[model samples]
Target: MPNTPERPRRISVEDQGPMLVEGPVEVTCADGSVAVSDRFVVAVCTCRRSRMYPWCDTSHRRRVKREENTEAEDGPAS
Candidate 1:
């Protein structure tokens, strides 16, 4: 039998969240470095606030929530 190429990987993107990708994946970063994952699925960071760059550590959730709470307490400036 002839060999066939594997199917393309699916990546889910959101307006304000990490990109969900099927793994294992090899990501080449902007600095010419590579990030690898062996998990079944991975969340690639898009907010650039992750302690683990190229991966999601749920920092977006905590940071955004904290900022929102702060703004609510301070209220709008006149």
Candidate 2:
């Protein structure tokens, strides 16, 4: 039988973001739970805040703080 070539795996890392790996991929959790993704590309969470666990939900974005208006703090405008 002729030997077949193996496909290469690719992985991408972004600054302050999840790692992207070529899929379809399977992930096994510490609790024996398994997660499978069939997308062409998959994002693995590194910040650990994703509701989907090992998946990236883009929740790593910076949060904006709302500033209070000085006029409102001084008691309504005259």
Candidate 3:
């Protein structure tokens, strides 16, 4: 929950991907400028390894791929 924004209107966990953020989003950058908008979804990173900081820059996909590769390498239970 490190990425949980305060007072988010809605947050949804997408199927096998990032959590989609929606509603009135008030973004405050390091420069101190604020932007408030109520609109569509924003993909929030769940992997905690996004270069984009707070956004889902497809880092989770990499994790998923790694997991899949591990599973494949492990093969079936004997």
Candidate 4:
């Protein structure tokens, strides 16, 4: 019998964040590029702000109170 790769069977979703899926995933970009992940689990970015495209680096997180305060202090609206 030939060995076969196991398919992903689980997925986790966050309220306002990335979608976590079982990995060994391959992502193909519009520019003819490809991103591959062999992690047990992969975070797919939903906010489109990830520095690591096709993956989440917590860029979808809501701004915390401290961050809002700092931005208010130095923001262009000030």
Query: What clash pairs does model 4 have?
Result: none
Residue 35 accuracy (lDDT) in model 3: 46
Candidate 2 deviant stretches above 4 angstroms: 1-5, 66-78
Ordered from best to worst TM-score, the candidate numbers read 2, 1, 4, 3
Writing each residue's lDDT as its tens digit, candidate 4 over 2-78 gives: 21457435779888899897776777777989888889889988788999978999988877764357565778663
lDDT of 1: 0.83
Q: How well does model 4 score by local distance difference test? A: 0.78
Q: Judged by TM-score, which candidate is best?
A: 2
lDDT of 1 at 59: 69
Overall lDDT per candidate, in order of appearance: 0.83, 0.85, 0.65, 0.78
Among the numbered candidates, top lDDT falls to 2
Q: lDDT tens string, model 3, 9-58?
A: 67788776887777446666567876454557777667667787556778
List the candidate numbers ranked by lDDT, top first: 2, 1, 4, 3
- Model 2: residue 75 alpha-carbon error in angstroms: 18
Candidate 3 residue 29 Cα shift, in angstroms, is 10
